[model samples]
Target: MSEDVLSQGEIDALLSAISSGEMDADELKEQKQEERKVRDYDFKRALRFSKDQIRGLTRIHENFARLLTSFFAGQLRSFSEVSVASVDQVPYEEFVRSMPQRTVLNIFSVEPLEGRIMYEVNPNIAYAILDRTLGGEGKSSNKVDSLTEIESRIMSRLFEKAFESLEEAWGSLVEIDLTLEEFEVNPQFIQMVSPNETVVIVSLNAQIGETSGMMNICIPHMVLEPIISKLSVHYWMQKEKTKSSPEDAEHLSKSLNNVDVEAKVLLGESGVSIEEFLKLNQEDVIMLNQSIEEPLVMHINNEPKFYVQPGKQKRHMAVQILGETRGEEE
Candidate 1:
């Protein structure tokens, strides 16, 4: 064997050459294409969400804005105005299709392959917000000016805040990320509803009057599915919580103990003339002279409780207790 050893660079070159054979250029290309296809399909399908989910998410944003407005009401020379810009639908693939224009400039799209709710920001609105947040330190006040680095950073922070507000208000159930996508002015976006596709578009714009720009919130349809399902489940749960079966609604009664009390029983034989009762009004007594062996009716809590006879409990009034009182036969 030769005592001479291969140089590090030569050995590296040899290893590279050997590995290159295992990955054919054409086969690698095909594999990459397959992966892209799978990813694209997933993106398209994952872009949808239900209507209730959109409302829930919007509520989150509203609550977040309210908190911010309250916190910085004084130092905040600027305030944001929010609005729903557009709601529309497109084929999942069509929405994600790449455009062929713009030769020199790179027009790469960051949109997911699924259909999306495209949100736009009024640059001026963003500037106003950013100026108040990141503005005090040598920031431009130009309404039409594109976002500066500081402005972008401030906007990023605000967006993150908005996302968090959404989660907190909605119970941390969804994940959301912002992406810049290629937008086209499509007439379909203006229609009131899209039932065929079952796509819901919700746009929330936050604008500062000082700056003419705004922030756009685009929620895809897929993000709302869980919310919708959850709402339905909640509604059903509420109904179930209040529901009761006939057997479960049956009422039972418990017997009450007897209490002795004396009552004067007026039998049919005891009679007083109307003339005699009227003539002897003051200090006159109409008495029912009955036998001492007669049982007297007893009352408890102002109701007829039972039948009992007079008895002695030292000096207190008492009665011989009878069986349970009849309560209209159940």
Candidate 2:
């Protein structure tokens, strides 16, 4: 605390400056007040996530963007692109106020987590998706104020299917089962979190064909608080490293063992003039270049793998593996 106490020389210099009119007394008082104001903190707008956590959120959502791009491309049967625009933290009330009056607000719950999150789509993109799904040239109906019963069901089903991609994207960070709980057009009607609750907003820019708009995801701090530590670059890196364990390799080998592969034995190769081939009669004999004792090459998935001898087993013809095929012969 010695640094906090003023020295005699410093006190004398301050008094001399004040007496000489070098510094105004009122100005000094106001400067101290301004410094105090600068130090004031607002709990309502608290930052719950660190920079590393925000970067992890960005990386996760970037992957979600890619998955959404492919999903929309296939579902709409049009060119689609999705990319991360920004990730920010703000009060829940501010996020709600920033939304347009009429938009697609999907409230979904992540199972094994306590609270719900919002997936909001801009009116333009939502209408574009609806128009495309209904067999029109992908276009947005800007004047849409409400969804009809049919339209609501269609969109609900469409987004529910799209959530599969969301599930897959978050699988690396956490296993979540997303169930669409509610759908609303008016933001005022929904209050999943407190007004001043801290929430992270992930904005995504999406274009389906010629229509493009923003998609925002609102996740409250309370919802993420439980697993907040997992939302870090270090955790993601560790998770990725764990995926390559011996158990995973064994599981992969077992999965591959069940896969079917085509294997065909090449009997021989013979060439003849087109005219001679066309003029050939029934029971016509064309001698092949391969000799009887020569082993036939066996091709697996169209690549020569081994040499085998042709023979019959019971009622079916089969080939006896002789040895591996020489690369030079191939």
Candidate 3:
């Protein structure tokens, strides 16, 4: 290179910065120091799960929810619906804070998956289950009572049953034998993970007949980090494909194809209070918010999937496709 050149504009900008103290020696040193400074990290809280992993966890626990629903129904000999309410990554302390102070906390470990996991049963539901077991009509109580020998036996039985369902739910992803290592009533004494460590909190709503309560499972991020790759969407889809034979897959497709789904066209919607709704007659008309020219909503499986126009198809009524909803994407 013959010579390096600095344009007049660049020179003027540098001179201006120097005069304004932006490029002063102390300022330059401060800038470098700031650039080199490391971020302050709190040891008490950290998150590790990504959105996709959270979605996968939600899907996994949804299966667990259905299993628990049926399990509780059979055990209670009554109607029971257990649903996974939410799956979230939270600090271990936050998870503990949301749990009942006097509820039973069963800490367990599974072979092939390292570290302890926590399972909590709300006292209300636990009491209801125990009440039903003792031939008493199922009842819920907020009172937290110490478990005597007989109650402990009942709890042990319930814990075993829960573990069996959990293991089965996890079987499609990984086969592991869960063993209960410790059980405690007060959560303050329990340490599933460090206070700052992030854990996945799987919250569940359990309904026993008319009574209802909540349950939760705390899984530390460290425990899942080893098998993190298996928690991705593509990995799960691949796993499902590998589990099915060609004939079985064909059978599944055919069965699904034969299944009937609710398909209806929405005219429009109008909201009414209880008093206004009770006063209405069949012939009385309620104006809808949607315009007449707007495409009607086509719903399948109770979800809006398409917008279409009302039309005639020979002798039958038909709908012309307008567009699909955001949720209808491939």
- List TM-scores for all candidates, in order: 0.35, 0.66, 0.60
Poorest lDDT segment (10 consecutive residues) of candidate 2: 31-40
Q: Which residue runs does candidate 1 get wrong by more than 4 Å? A: 1-77, 80-120, 135-148, 172-199, 209-214, 231-330
Writing each residue's lDDT as its tens digit, candidate 1 over 154-243 gives: 555554444444334444443444343333233233322243344443344444544443344434455444445544445545645875
Query: Judged by TM-score relative to the true structure, which candidate is superior, 2 or 3?
Result: 2
In candidate 3, the residue pairs with backbone N, CA or C atoms under 3 Å apart (3 or more residues apart, or in different chains) clash, namely 44-196
Model 3, stretches more than 4 Å misplaced? 1-44, 240-330
Q: How do the residues 186-256 of candidate 2 rate in per-residue lDDT, one tens digit apiece? A: 89999999899999999999999898999999999987888889988888778778757798999999999
Q: lDDT per residue, candidate 3, 35-86, as tens digits?
A: 6746677656655888998988888889989998888778779988989999
Judged by lDDT against the true structure, how good is candidate 3?
Answer: 0.83
Error of 1 at 226 (Å): 3.7
Report, for every candidate in turn, its global Cα lDDT versus the true structure.
Answer: 0.46, 0.89, 0.83
Candidate 1 vs candidate 2, TM-score winner: 2
Off by over 4 Å in 2: 1-40, 243-330
Could you report the Cα RMSD, in angstroms, for every candidate shown? 23.7, 10.3, 13.5
